[model samples]
Target: MSEVDNYEIVRQKLTLGPLTTPKHRKIRRLLKIFWNEKEINLLSHFGPADEYNSLKQLQERSGLPKDEIKQILRNPLRKGTISKRGTKYCLEPIIPGIFEKYFQRSRDTEENLKKAAILYWDLFKEVLPQQDTKVDNDWSLFRPLLPLEANEKIIEINQEFDVQSQTLPYESVKNLIDKFEQFAVITCQCRLVAELSGEPCKVAPSEMGCFIAGPGSQTMIDGGIRGARLLNKDEAIEFLKETEKRGLVHNAVFDKGDQSSIFFCNCCGCHCGVLFPPKLFHERGAYQSNYSPKWDNDLCTKCETCMKKCPQKAIYHKFPVKSDSSDEQMVLREEMCIGCGVCAINCSDKAIKMVKVRDNVPPDRQKIGNKTFIEMLQ
Candidate 1:
């Protein structure tokens, strides 16, 4: 089929429910087919959606005939710059109103339309069976509005860390919060899913890294734009305290040195590409923690309680070693472990305990923030 014809087909498929206006659907489909397919997929992955697929992989998996697929990929109407990164292709911002129009919806239209849009993007790439990655513990999320000038202060604070290795001073954290005039309750899409589903979210609200400032910041705020639910220092603290009361945790607090903002993340073990290994993206760093979990076999009864409680599914159970006879043994996958205290909390034998593991940041933090936040915007 010609690119135009394919675009029509996609548009027809996308039209559903009250929100799917004919014009809107046509525009979305045209953009999808005409622009870089990889860029569309990347947007879906980065946005508040659940689509994650590489462009080339999607092309190979597409059942369309080679000629038709090539025609769609090479369509001239898809007027956008393509950015290639190690086989990945992304579409530059070509159409001005694409995001605004695509996301426009009445309250009732959201659930279904959002799902359809996400599924459409997934069609282009692989969807691995969902697995928890075991990095959920020791994380947090919060949205605080602070002064934009605080970004400079944060840079100064980080400069001190450049020469020394110590936890952020309580005074520094307090000073930044006090200086900021406003804050916003930033909600992550992944965390939103957990809340809507009534599932126990694994990531803490505090553990989320700040990426709105400095050289590698992942968040973006319009300069001097003040319209959201901005909170002052006292209000911000109250908001965070309420979040914790609702069972959410905080991992870290950051002063971006600009607008006062708090990042609230709902992280999981799996699907959180940032928390996993193989370092798919160079811009993101690792997840860091101040503590690790220690196992005492003597207290263990070979029970598998820890394995079941693990959100990342990192823990395993095995039988004890047989001195001379044949018996099963229990074991823990330390490599896959994220040192969350869930296993220890649930362990009947009390064999697991969280102890200070190291002082370095975990590699996954940078990856998730950079890939999902910064790279997507660029």
Candidate 2:
């Protein structure tokens, strides 16, 4: 078929992923910017975002020579437009896939980067608000991992659940870091996009980015993707601590609950892709940690440190009536909180403590919330 047909096919395949590339005019413009005609034609031979195709399979499907197929894939693979595993390759969704790959690297032209940034930001504002109306029943791919300091000592468990048997691994930043040996740090794509869009993050540097650990991450890092570097265990821990000190929340994709964490980010609500959309619409987008900050009224002193430190803006002061002499108490909008423990960790008066609120285990691998991973994104 023609180049237009190929682009349309690729768009359909992308929309089938967990994140969508809706058929907007801007999306068509973005697709062209990310992929040239030949690459788009090659991409049409692949299956949906969730399915990978072997080189042999692609060759048969496209009726192209193995060498020719490899040539077509070379640029897209380097650019991260395509996902790969050994000899297999697959398409990726626009938001999590191509948008990130395009902006995260310093190799792209300034003009092209500016174009992609504007389009993606516009897309987010237009499409995400639609999700806001349905926020009450929303599911999230990312969830908070409470601060390391929010240990059993600070967080109270439910009486019905045995405290001794409750081992919530990968539920805190430290535990998640300990689960993997090799680690790498890259610029936060969300912050980078914000910077490109002229709204730089105020909470932390874009360089204070996300942590990539676990298996194959080292191999991926070793490949020398631009704007990324390796980090040892101690450095990784230190990096997380630094972000926490800046009042940034630790968020990750922990598909296996206590057993697995694919990747994690130190995010500020100001510019985080996972956090910003919900914040913009005053809706819930991320899964909360099992803890919430419990305030000690007598000890609070009403200093408002916790309020300032909360990333979600969930904490607010409830001033006493004019007739009463009672001090203004710190109140939490529990629904607005992601149970990140940022306020608890930052409170100087020891007034805020994380308390175990809910105990729903995260969904298994290949699943997000109640949907199959692909279904959730789609």
Task: Specify the highest-TM-score model's number.
Answer: 2
RMSD of each: 13.9, 3.7
For model 1, how does the per-residue alpha-carbon lDDT over 259-304 read when each residue is reduced to its tens digit? Answer: 2222323233432323322112211112323434566767667667
lDDT of 2 by residue, 187-230 (tens): 88788777788877788878888777775456546655546777
Q: What are the TM-scores, per candidate, against the unseen true structure?
A: 0.39, 0.86
- State the lDDT at 69 in candidate 1: 41
Query: What's the CA RMSD of model 2 in angstroms?
Result: 3.7
Worst 10 residues of 1 by lDDT: 277-286
Highest-lDDT candidate: 2
Model 2 local distance difference test score: 0.72
Candidate 1 TM-score over all chains jointly: 0.39
Colliding residue pairs in candidate 2? 18-377
